[model samples]
Target: MAEVSAEARIEAPAEKVWAKLTDFSVYGEWNATHTSFPKGPPASLEVGGQFEENMKLMGFPAEVTWTVEDLADTRTLAIRGKGPMGVNVGTRYTLTADGDATTVRVDGEFTGAAVSLMAGKLKDSATAALNESLRKLAGLVT
Candidate 1:
């Protein structure tokens, strides 16, 4: 299994950051890993909602079918998905409001027979991607 996480403090209110985070229409503009959504983002975000996303991981293109596992308005959102090669992945986004600033953290996990073979490299790539995603999110929202 491989896991990765990253955090960033954006100089923007939680509401502002949350708006941009949940707005999938602009995700491609700020999310470095996002490629496209074949059927589009979920109409509503809630536990059990499903969405398909095209992603680029470690320079390799892949598609995932994701299901919302948890959510809390402006506070937390998590999704679990299955990708190619029997890989299972999960990502959790957490938002903590601090006065006018928001602390955003992303936690990711990969588990599957394939993960153990490239755990180190996958961790490095995923960590960088998470950090880059956060930086882009801050740039777009703040």
Candidate 2:
């Protein structure tokens, strides 16, 4: 199992940040690697909601059909994705309200055959990419 976590304090309310992040239909707006994608159907935050997300990762077409594993409004959102590579990845977003700013934490876990081989080399890159994305998102919201 390989895990990567990144946290950032966005100069926006927790609810506001959560709204923007959970808006899977518009992730391409602030997420650099996920750009050039179109909005999709309305997907809710819950324990069993399933949806498809198409984006670019490392210049490749990265698409995943994920299911919501857990959710807590303005605090946490967890999801799991399964694929041929046996990739079982999970993303957790935690929010903390600080006056008018919200500290958002985006954590991810990858467990499977593909990840086992290159876990060490990928961790730093994943963290950097996620942190960079959070910075971009902060700029978009604030």
Candidate 3:
């Protein structure tokens, strides 16, 4: 398995960060890996909700069918998905409010046979993507 994470301190409240984080309509605008939502974002963001996303990583395109694993308003969101070549993907977003600013962390995991072949490269690419995504997200909210 390959694991990656990135963190950023945004100059905005958790509520504002969470609003942009969960608002799937604008997800692709800041999410580096996101290409598009195949059927649009989930209608509602309850646990067990499902959505299809088209993504690109390391210059390769993939489609993932994701199931929401956890959710907490203005605090956390987690999802797991099945991706190309039997790879399993998991992502979690965490937010901690500190006065008027928010600290956001994104954690990711990749498993299955495919990951073993290029774990190092995947980790580098994913970590970079997460960092870039956070920067974009921060730009949007702050």
Candidate 4:
């Protein structure tokens, strides 16, 4: 398994940050790994909601079928997905408000046989992607 995380303090309120985070319509605008949503964003965002996302990770393109595992308005969102080559992917977004600023953290994990073959490289790539995603997200909201 490979795990990665990134955190950033954005000069914006939690509400503003959450709006941009959950707005899948413009997800690609800031999300570094996102290539496109083949069927668009999910109609509703709730536990069990499913969506298909086309993503590029570790320099490879993949289609992942994701299910919303958890959600909390303006606070948290977690999703688990099944990717190619029997890989399992999990991502979580967390937001904490501190007066006028919001601290956002993204956590990700990849597990499967494929991951074992490239754990080190995958961690490096994923960590970079998460940091880039957070930077872009901050630019949009702050």
Candidate 5:
């Protein structure tokens, strides 16, 4: 399995950050790297709720399905998802209050046939994307 983890400190409160993070609909607005996403069957963000999205990964368009596996109000959120590219992605977002700011960490594990071959490249790419997205997300919240 290939994995990547990136973190950033945003000048916002945990609650504020969590509110925005949990609202999956606005992901496109903040996450510049992702393009396509599901349209209908509006999904709720419950522990077991699921959502589907289409996005470009490694220059290829792929469909991904994500299921909420854990939630911790304003602290952490975790999900398990799979993409049409034969990639299984496990993602986790953790928020920690730091004096008047919030430290956000986004980590992911990419597994399966597609990712198993180029483990180093996959990890590097995911880390880059996550870092970029975290910077953008921090800017949005702050």
Candidate 6:
């Protein structure tokens, strides 16, 4: 398995950041891994709700079906997904409000027989993507 995380302190409130995060219609503009949502983003964000996402990871494109596993109004959201080649992926977005600013962290994991074969490279690539995503997100929300 490979794990990667990135954090950013944005000059925006949690509610504003949360809105941009869940606004999937514009996700591809900021999310580094995003390709498209073939079936569109979920109409609502709730535990057990599922969505499909086309993504490019480590330069390979894949379609993943993800289920919302956790939620907390403007604080946290976590999803678990199944991708091609038997890959299991998990992503968690945590937001901490500090006055008018919000600190957000994106943590992700990839696990599968295939992951073990290139864990180091995958980790490096994923880490880069996470940081880039955070930068873009901050730009949009803050």
- Write down the TM-score for model 6: 0.98
Better candidate number, 3 or 5, judged by TM-score: 3
Give one digit per residue, the lDDT tens place, for model 1 in 83-125: 9999999999999999999999999999999999999999999
TM-score of 2: 0.86
lDDT of 3 by residue, 8-40 (tens): 999999999999998888999999999998887
Which window of 10 residues has the lowest lDDT sum in candidate 3?
Answer: 37-46
TM-scores, all candidates, are 0.98, 0.86, 0.99, 0.98, 0.91, 0.98
TM-score of 3: 0.99
The whole-model lDDT of each prediction reads 0.94, 0.76, 0.97, 0.96, 0.81, 0.94
For model 5, name the residue pairs that clash: none
For residue 44, model 1's alpha carbon misses the true position, in angstroms, by: 1.7
| Count of backbone collisions within predicted model 1 | 0
Q: Model 6: runs farther than 4 Å from truth?
A: none
Lowest-sum lDDT 10-residue window in model 5: 33-42
| lDDT digits (tens) for residues 1-142 of candidate 6 | 9999999999999999999999988898889999989998889999999999999988999999999999999999999999998999999999999999999999999999999999999999999999999999999987
Which clashing pairs does model 4 show? none
Local lDDT at 41 for model 2: 47
Model 5 lDDT at residue 54? 72
User: lDDT (0-100) at residue 95 of candidate 5?
Assistant: 97
Which of candidates 3 and 5 reaches a greater lDDT?
Answer: 3
Q: Which 10 residues in a row give candidate 2 its minimum summed lDDT?
A: 33-42
Shift of residue 78 alpha carbon in model 3, Å: 0.3
Model 1 clash pairs are none
Number of the top candidate by lDDT? 3
